[model samples]
Target: MTDNSAERRREKQPRTGAEQPWEPEDLVISEGKDPTPERLEEARRRLADEGPSAIERSAP
Candidate 1:
């Protein structure tokens, strides 16, 4: 029989960014801390317009 435990060791671990993926703060469009109201509005506007196109857009 094959040694399956070796394969278990090679399993990929899930990424854990500081914030959970669904948090509102995670979607900030501002450069850094203390985002202005305009920046927040712009971020929200872009999200409303873009939808799924904004998510995980990078190619394989």
Candidate 2:
């Protein structure tokens, strides 16, 4: 059997808060597609209004 305690610890660790403010790049509109200016602006607004949770809500 393999010792997997370290991996488990990493997985169980709470996520750290954002070190920097959200940027347009942080908004992933799609996997491979690039975001348009309008989408980026929308994301920016959402980030301002909703905080980090906007990222998850923006993408599919």
Highest-lDDT candidate: 2
What is the lDDT for 11 in model 1?
Answer: 68
- Model 1 per-residue lDDT tens digits across residues 1-60: 889886787565543332233222334532344556765676566556665343333111
Q: Estimate the Cα RMSD of every predicted model relative to the unseen true structure.
A: 6.7, 6.5
TM agreement with the true structure for every prediction: 0.38, 0.50
Give the lDDT of residue 31 in candidate 2. Answer: 27
Cand. 2 TM to true fold? 0.50
lDDT of 1 at 12: 59
Q: Model 2 residue 32 lDDT?
A: 37
Runs in model 1 deviating more than 4 A are 1-24, 29-33, 55-60
User: Given candidate 1, what's the lDDT at residue 8?
Assistant: 81
> Which lDDT values do the candidates have, in the order given?
0.46, 0.66
Say which candidate scores most in TM-score. Answer: 2
